[model samples]
Target: MTPHSVTLDLGGRTALVTGAASGIGRACALRLAAAGAKVRAVDRDAEGLAALERAAPDAVETVRLDLTDLAAAEQAAAGVDVLVNNAGLQVVRPLEEFPPDAFRLVLTVMLEAPFRLIRGALPHMYGQEWGRVVNISSVHGLRASAYKAAYVAAKHGLEGLSKVTALEGAAHGVTSNCVSPAYVRTPLVERQIADQARLHGIPEERVVTDVMLTDSAVKRMVEPEEVAEAVAYLCAPQSSVITGSSLPLDGGWTAH
Candidate 1:
């Protein structure tokens, strides 16, 4: 797909993006920085963060953080004008077989960390009378598939959290919304291929063609830039009235 341009004047804004090491988070960090925002790129992957620094020497500042460290995650979000909660991990297993620790970790990073980050960021936003909290939710937030119990649960929780934030933040000039997407061409998705195949008893190629894309009407994976563009749209000045919404980039997957 052809890449489209993003136009926004975030000249003096400070944006913090979690999971900024690669994939969708990386795309969003670059996109916002291109619009003139000073971006704090957060991820536990020091090497990936280093690559991001090389990609945009002056626009990005890299912070190595594991969202499991909830306090530090919250601290990193303080005083930022924009917060993008995009860090996530996945484990493909049935509910009963899902590891307990993995479940806790998933909820910690994908759900609790966002809550803490928002909690930390809201005060500064309220003081300034403006802020944008964009959670990188998933198609699973609205729909569910087998062998993804933890992921789906966390996303559903995130969706509810985003709505509540929107309501509380409305009067404070802060808007919280979610950008939910279907499978994208990212490292996370690529890794899931083997897991999905293992569980589904199919080859890796078949996992992509049969199980993964089964419900995607568009018949192709969404692009990271595409998701980044949607995030940018929600952050636009005109989007002030567009709070409490979950914009789906699911290729009509939920249409069914």
Candidate 2:
């Protein structure tokens, strides 16, 4: 299909997006809703989830839960046709300085929770003979950088999980793929900038260029909608044949 042929006809589908209160998750929730999917927007922030429900009352259902709770994550995935694993945290510290506790926290949230959610949701999708799993991995998953060991490791593990899920689910018509993006202007990225500057003793300006956009040929932060567009494509009907892949919305960051 041509780029223009991509359209959302998810009227009968049910989508569950974690971390839907803001940034890429929020954008994905809204895009899925606009495309006619009944979206369950999950986030730990009750106020933000409420705001999303208010903004798209007709299109979304709000679920406020901390995904770190394995049971809660599993419950959240139950009965969903599409699972967008977009909830994650970042910790930018040199491996030598990285706290064990902090590393575990990042891994649990980014990798462990998604793995549980996918496993929990699989039976539902398998029974129906259709499903989609969109993991919001990062460009760092493919490459590497200094002072981001935990985040990079979790993302890389997520890609592997996506591949395994794709291979197993392929026969059942449940496609699994990941969208790897460069830095996007999200609250998460904004926080990363401040944290990196303080950790590395560099100017905030340098953080954006020397770190976030260092490898991007486009030299600009990606937009949430740009990433959401890719998610929509993966969730679409035509993407049935597209599985076990990492689609880059990286502004050519990985092209080099």
Candidate 3:
């Protein structure tokens, strides 16, 4: 964690953060709540939501709803001043062997759900003439990996969606951008390590150093708080001019 945080003052704003049960989403909910925004922490995990609310008992409102429920997801996003599309799951398999059902679920949660949430948030945002949409994209959004077919595809689609929202919402004082990070030190990625190990027939430690951090000049995994900090920066007053762009926290993976 950084010794000093870049404080963002978001008084009177209602921010709805998806995937708030853990990892990057949890950090964002906490950071925004600390910034004085009324945070609606949404996640499918009821117990995780409870834990998150306990962390900021007065500042965060917990909403437990699966994003796969498109209508419910849209309804949950209504009237939110800031929308953080951060909920995602990954399935690793080669193209011919990837389960169609899992692929469908991944896209539904990662891509279509963001579309519905953004749709629901737009009327309020356009009416108020001020809003922020921060999509928690991945480095896979920019670059592809072998067994992560579904994940890469969903993130790439999300990148396109974010840019389109930026273009359409530009005139209405709404800014939509993506914060793309490389391997984060989250359980999801830890599970991914196991998946990659099995796929490559390698040990778990070898998967981490050789596969996960191969392209990253900085070999260490990124912390969730770092990604959240970038999200907070994009929501600050200084970020009004940074629409339709991607902020990469990939430890210089793209430098190659």
Candidate 4:
């Protein structure tokens, strides 16, 4: 909503952004492209990808494929200078009632997919001696909420994966980090609003104020652009020394 002040020049770099068709992914795609990177926008949503490419001034190449196809997901990241793993889905249910298939898919997409993508990306990065791996995580990554067993588990695993990537990539000039944000105004979070309300036995209207913002000192959902800005900053030249770190965009939730 506010003006973007920071400037980044990634003119010659090739950036691959997963889930690039919407929300924070869309914003990150646009931001990186604006910084002059040859961005390969990956998403399963063809319609959304088309809209994104049409709206851009330059050509934004899009890969339309589901990340659950692990081999394809890995292949999609080949030869990119920057990788942003942002594709994820959430299933809200108590652990006892959670569907086993849903949990497996969640872990497959969020955790395993990132692993394969990193596996696909590292050789190229190590060969070139430069790369950036930015994972879009959430405050739930650092904390926890009830009735989100699968989502929380996957994020926690992702946090670990990101750190390990950072350690292994350090000597190779490949820095891996996570941008952990609180609730953002995105489709994923929007879908959960009602679920949260029902689980907590609160009216839908109260979900946003009382539940979502309970630990958030700011009491407002984060804008996708704000999260994108952090992503941009992490990939910038100045952030060379910052790696294996969890950058919190939590609206003060983690400050507790």
TM for every model, in the order presented, reads 0.98, 0.96, 0.98, 0.97
For candidate 4, write residues 133-249 as lDDT tens digits: 999998989999999888889999999999999999999999999999999999988999888888899999999899999999998999999998999888888999999999999
lDDT of 3 by residue, 1-256 (tens): 8543676888999999999999999999999998999999999999999999999998999999999999999999999999999999999999999999999999999999999999999999999999999999999999999988889999999999999999999999999999999999987888788889999999988998989999999999999999999999999988899999999999999999
Clashes of 3: 0
How far is 136's C-alpha from truth in model 4 (Å)? 0.3
Better model by TM-score: candidate 1 vs candidate 2: 1
lDDT of each: 0.94, 0.92, 0.95, 0.92
Q: Per-residue alpha-carbon lDDT of model 1 for 40-99, expressed as tens digits?
A: 999999999999999999999999998999999889999999999999999999889999
As for candidate 4, its clashing pairs are none
Work out candidate 2's RMSD over C-alphas. 2.0
CA RMSD per model (angstroms): 1.4, 2.0, 1.3, 1.4
For candidate 2, the per-residue lDDT at 248 reads: 86
Clashing pairs in 2: none
**Model 3: lDDT of residue 93:** 97
Model 1 score (lDDT): 0.94
Cα error, candidate 3, residue 22 (Å): 0.5
lDDT for 110 (candidate 3):
99
Which of candidates 1 and 3 is the stronger one according to lDDT? 3
